[model samples]
Target: MERRKGTIVNVGSITALAPGPWAGVYSASKAALHALSDSLRVELKSFGINVMTVAPGGTKSNLGNSSAAKYDQTHDWKYYKKYEEGLRARTEISQGPGSTPAEELAKKVVASVLKKNPPAWFAYGQFSAILSVLYYAPLWFRDYFYRLVMKC
Candidate 1:
């Protein structure tokens, strides 16, 4: 905490606000961090700390693909296989569709931080758009959504 000065950006997922079945635990942990970020922003305000939480949508990264691969190898998705196509589509976002580049995301993040009066919360990308809307929808709607998109 002492090592850094100025702003502290905590990376969270859009799923932190609203979770899906495939990553319930991951979303919960991120939600915890999101709460912590909110708390610290208030606590450290007197000390001139600018805390911002970046709820990045699905950015292109190798980690998600690797996890999916591992799951394929070890997870007996006998049940989930029913939703195999949907699962593949959902997981592919983390691996990217080549539409929104990672470098572009980084640039936007950097630009946001560089602002003198930066937003306390910021989101970007296609999944961000989808998530922002989904975050407000009714629970049943969201459930139906997961079933539809995940094809469960």
Candidate 2:
């Protein structure tokens, strides 16, 4: 990352900060990007290379509609079935009405890349805020909070 001089907008997600029901893998992947950005920023800052991390919130897109495994409701993880309704509800969030238009996000992203002084990290939309907190919270705090919020 330090070898070149250019802007790198790493696409993170609310999942990275807050890992919740039915999307552990997705969240972890995004979280990895966030962590990577944290390291890369310092490593590349002196070289005039801007490494920014953008965490997008809920937006209407096909990303979640098509997940890793589209297993039928009849066949699911044993313990997970107990929280099936909650899982479905959480999954629906990405496609919910509050979703920021994808184009809107893309436009902002492009503008950020073209900025004279781009932000170190940019988070847009709903869950992005929660994820930021989760990224800084204690382990017990995050776990208990999730349990209380989901009632599971």
Candidate 3:
């Protein structure tokens, strides 16, 4: 890496920006990565390395299906039993019809990262805009929106 300048692309999720119900752990992990990327970007700049954080929203992929497979919606719950279906649905939310194709996102990322001046942050895929809005929205508005959408 010291011989030649290169870009380090860190893939995160939109959840890191505006976390919602039933995916706190996942969101938190991604948020950590986002933070790390931000710090690394500055720390590595003097070394001729560019760090780019990619926060993808809902993109078409098997991740959702795989996650849904492992989820046991039938399991007994102590507090969120009433929201079982909603919780399970969280895993499949990104697989919806409007989700962006993974290939499309991949191509964009590749092109962006290869540029002489790559952006520090690149966010794409469905729900990216909405999530960004939620990220900047008032706390009460975000809370109300999530409650209404999650039906919780």
Candidate 4:
């Protein structure tokens, strides 16, 4: 804020770490947000407004089921019908037991925000570690990994 010189936090998704099949648009949007946050972090530094980007991997929520339901209701894939099962599975992949609790992520984010020197980049929750690995892997390896896991 101009008055108080507060922090700006942008919440992105771990999916933005890599561009893969099935969720390309979503990934691109999140990726754009991350980029914007990075730029803002520098541009707003002089104003004493800290910018932080949080890329949550998978927090516990009903998102998976809701996504599946919406996809099933709205999309009737004629040519890509063969990949329907895989697509559906992708929607629910993050709502499993391995996901970090929403409350836990909230607490961590709040704690970080309250800190005098909050982290510029923070990533937490399930699938975050593996996703980071994928992000750092070579392009070829990342492609292979996604092909294998996403059934692309």
lDDT of candidate 1 over 1-152, digit per residue (tens): 47445898998888787788777788999899899999999998877788889888887778677766865775578877777777677667566664356788889989999899777788886577777788899999999998877776
- Residues forming the 10-long window of minimal summed lDDT in candidate 1: 91-100
Better of 1 and 3 by TM-score: 3
Q: How close is candidate 3 to the true structure, as a TM-score?
A: 0.93
Instruction: Decide which is better by TM-score, 3 or 4.
Output: 3
Question: Per-candidate TM vs. native?
Answer: 0.87, 0.81, 0.93, 0.92
Q: Write the per-residue lDDT of candidate 3 for residues 2-93, one digit (tens) a residue.
A: 66588999999999999998889999999999999999999999889999999999998999998877655546555766886887778888
Error of 3 at 115 (Å): 0.8
C-alpha local distance difference test of each model: 0.80, 0.79, 0.90, 0.87
Summing lDDT over every window of 10 consecutive residues in candidate 4, give the lowest-scoring window: 71-80
TM-score of 1: 0.87
Clashing pairs in 2: none
Q: List the residue pairs that clash in candidate 4.
A: none
Sort by TM-score, top down from the best: 3, 4, 1, 2
Between candidates 3 and 4, name the one with more favorable lDDT.
Answer: 3
Candidate 2 lDDT tens digits, 1-152: 44657888899886777687567888889889899999999898888898899988998788657642353444546867678666666766778887888999999889888998899888898777786788799989888887877657
lDDT of model 1, residue 3: 46
